[model samples]
Target: MGFESVSDFLAMGGHGLYVWLSYAIALVVVVLNLIAPLRTKKQIHKEQARRLRREQSQI
Candidate 1:
């Protein structure tokens, strides 16, 4: 389908709100999927460092 102008393209036959909202939600899910693992890895590394420090102090 061809749109006569940018406004019409964005309006998306009056379904724009639903379509855009779905895209926004999917984007958020994708971003969270990428961030969660990296955050977990960082937390694990921090805990391991703390444990190493404690062990060294005991030596």
Candidate 2:
């Protein structure tokens, strides 16, 4: 609606590259920030579970 055509939308009067790049970077950072914590938590839980199993086997 704001643009006249596909080319116009993509061009954004020559500022499209900067605008799109910023959006892409922001999306990547947001996704990584969201996923990294869950991955870390999973790794920690796995390590602790393995340690517990090893200790139990030793006993």
Candidate 3:
């Protein structure tokens, strides 16, 4: 873990492409895991609001 520079650190013992790609894919999956739940929550809230409004209108 004692690389002289940023380039050397990222080079990862000449496996840079595979290492960086794995990191990128991991990041994407984590971000999607976070985002998907929030999106579903928003959809649920919208549906609940619509249902409430319909019930109010019926009364």
Candidate 4:
């Protein structure tokens, strides 16, 4: 409502770069936070499977 157009809204009164950059950074952080746990879980599963295989082979 305060902005006259899409461009004006994007401009954000000349603070658009900072605001958008912060938003992008926040998005990246959130995505990484989500991905990291999944990756760690996958890694742990692989390690456990490998360990299980090794123990079974020893029998």
Candidate 5:
């Protein structure tokens, strides 16, 4: 099962839409999984900094 050209390979025997879409969705999910934790960590750092500043200002 060999494709003679790039187009044929992408077509994937006329199931290209499902195949490519699934790949794209999987990629997005993987990227989000990576990013979500970093974003959450940043948010937590920001909140902690704000709380520390407030406590220092009170003193």
Candidate 6:
């Protein structure tokens, strides 16, 4: 299972579209999995800070 050239590797025995699309989807899922948690944490921290400010102002 060896490719003599880059084009051969990319073509992937005529299944290139499916293979590449699957890889692209997997990569996007991995990226989103990473980003979603960080985004949620940031949003939570922002809300907490606002809550604290509101509490302090009430005193």
Error of 5 at 51 (Å): 0.2
lDDT of 2 at 36: 100
Better of 3 and 5 by lDDT: 5
Can you write out model 3's per-residue Cα lDDT over 1-59, one digit (the tens) per residue? 79999999899889999999999999999999999999999999999999999999999
* Residue pairs in clash, model 5: none
Off by over 4 Å in 3: none
> What is the TM-score of candidate 6?
0.97
lDDT by residue for model 2 (17-47), tens: 9989999999999999999999999999999
| lDDT by residue for model 6 (1-59), tens | 99989999999999999999999999999999999999999999999999999999999
Q: Which residue window of length 10 is worst by lDDT in model 3?
A: 1-10
lDDT of each: 0.96, 0.96, 0.97, 0.96, 0.98, 0.98
User: For residues 1-59, could you state the per-residue lDDT of candidate 1 as single tens digits?
Assistant: 99999998888999989888999999999999999999999999999999999999999
TM-scores of the models, in the given order? 0.92, 0.87, 0.84, 0.96, 0.95, 0.97
- Minimum summed lDDT over a 10-residue window in model 6 is located at 8-17
Segments of candidate 2 deviating more than 4 angstroms: none
Candidate 5's C-alpha lDDT?
Answer: 0.98
Candidate 5, residues 1-59: lDDT per residue as tens digits? 99989999999999999999999999999999999999999999999999999999999
User: How far is 55's C-alpha from truth in model 2 (Å)?
Assistant: 1.2
What value does the lDDT take at residue 47 in candidate 1?
100
Candidate 4 vs candidate 6: the lDDT winner is 6
lDDT of 4 by residue, 1-59 (tens): 49999998998999999989999999999999999999999999999999999999999
Steric clashes per prediction: 0, 0, 0, 0, 0, 0
